[model samples]
Target: MTIERIRVLGLGKVGELVAHLLGGAGFEVAGGDLRPRPDLGFPVDVFDVGDPESLRSELDGFDAVVSCLPYDRNLGVAEAAAVAGLHYFDLTEDVPTTTRIRELAVGSDVVMAPQCGLAPGLVGIVGSSLADGLTDLRRMQLRVGALPQHPSGVLGYAFTWSPEGVINEYINDCEVIRDGHRQLVPAMADIETVVISGDRLEAFATSGGLGTLCETYDGRIRHLDYKTLRYPGHCDAIRFLLDELALRDRRELAGEILVNAKPPVDDDVVYLYAAVEGQGPDGLTRREYVRAWQPIEIAGRMWRAISWTTAASACGVVELVARGAVPGKGFLRQEDVSFDDLLSTPTGSLFRDEVAVA
Candidate 1:
């Protein structure tokens, strides 16, 4: 259960930060990418991520492997980790990918946890904690948004994270518990207005943000759902691109076009909101946790809010596994993660600190 050495796959924005945070927390960390990244302050291994044999060979000596690769590249990395008998973690929001990883975890000696990032990871943890305090859980609503502090153009968005991932979430079918029944609904179908910190925003159904909470809370909570928040009118613009323009049929091209139009922004804000309504000791009650996080200084360097928040959530879960605070074998569920334990870790404390709202 003592994880000393970790091998991080991919050296992108979130991946690099994850390695840095784990190293700062006293883990011997190294990185692997298609290109050389010697400037990451750790050893870097250049290898073909698509080749399964190379991936398994690279993961041999590490106690665990964290895959920050794109959602499509994670299954191979996860398979390699399983073969090496290493605990595995990933930031994938793809439902089919997580389902396959769950199959890999069965009867395995190491843990296989996926979806350990912002919406599916942190928001799931927060929502579950709030639900635990209630008697008759009626509804659980979770929302998260990563956007530029200032915006222009019709979209009013930036690609602070992966453009491919965003496009996948936008067009995929969402799973939710509606009217006490588990069902799949089209993404962007249910739109609602949400206000946070005097800012008016819109939220709509998104795929994979709920993680495993739909199954975990099925038949217990009357209504359970998750959504991605955006500035008003943003959803309409995206729908026009995917539906009216027929870009949903060509997701790769859509991603390329969107990223070209709205590149990643340095000054970004991450908004998180979770509310649980049920029966309390007094009567019907509602409990909510809301926070607005901005870019932060860590390890003497500034990190984008989206990057740090996602990295912190992944690293915090890894830290918990290292300390035996959670299960070390089989599949790990984000809803099962204790929010208090996450806040106690060095990486998770980054979320504990607040920043001025933009």
Candidate 2:
């Protein structure tokens, strides 16, 4: 159960950080991408994701594989993990891709865990912890967002994470539990303003943020939803592109335009917020958790808020699984993890604090 080696798939913003974090955490980490990124200062192999033969071969020796690739490109890596008898983890928020991984994990000995980043990963863990005290849980709301430390663009946002994932979130229907039933809600349809510490931000429904919590809390909770937090006008501009400009059908082009227009920022802030309301032991109760994290220097390297948080989440889960803290079989959900256990790890402690998890 001791994980001495791990393979990280992809070497982009989050992937590179994952390699650094895992390496520093004393794991023999090898990063793989379609192209070589030697500057990462780790052993990186070149392999095309479309070529399953090469992927499975590249993944053969690792104890676990963490896919930081775009959500669309995760299945091949998951399959490669299955073929290699290694534990599988990914940061995908795509519901269909997750379903595919679940189907692939069935009857397999290796563990399969998806949605191991930010909203879908940490938020779900926090949600479960918060709901534990509620005698009759009525509602739960999860919101997360990463923005430039100093906002200047007309969109008031920067390229914090994957552009493809952002566009997919905008165009896809969000899954939520309402009236004690699962339903698909339109993304960006419900816009609400929230004020935290003098900064007023807006939140809107976004797809795949809920992970598997809807199914876990369906009949137990009356209402549950997840949304993305952004500056006041950010959602409106994205809605314009997807709805008015007819970019919904042309997601690739839309992603290119957005990525081309926005410059990536290393200095950024990530926002986390969760609200729970229900009848506790005494009476009707309500509690909320809020935290704003800034770019932090870790292990002698500086990383953006989004990069560190996203990578930490995936690494944290794999670390637990590698240490025999988590099961190594079938599909796993975010709600299956323990928040306290996650915080005790070196990687997950990046988000540990009274403010971060309060």
lDDT of each model, Cα atoms only?
0.92, 0.86
Could you tell me which residue pairs clash in candidate 1? none
Every model's Cα RMSD, please? 1.3, 1.6
**lDDT tens digits, residue span 1-358, model 1:** 5699999998898999999999999999999999998677999999988997788788888999999998999999898888888999999999999999999999988889999999799999999998886877889999999999998799999998888899999989999998889999999988999998998989999999999999999889889999999999999999999989999999999999999999998999899999999998899999889999989999789999999999999999999999989998999999889999999999998877874343
If scored against the real structure, what TM-score would every candidate get?
0.98, 0.96
lDDT of 2 by residue, 1-358 (tens): 3578889888998999998888978899998888878677799898887898888788777888889999899987887787778888899999999998989889878789999999788889888878886877899999999988788866988887899999889888999989888999998988999776678889999999999999899789889999998999998898788889999899999999998888788889888898899998889998787888887888787888899888888888887887777776888888888878888788988777436432
Q: Candidate 1: list runs displaced more than 4 Å.
A: 355-358
Native-structure RMSD, model 2 = 1.6
RMSD of candidate 1 to true structure, Å:
1.3
Model 1 C-alpha lDDT versus the unseen true structure? 0.92
Error of 2 at 246 (Å): 1.6
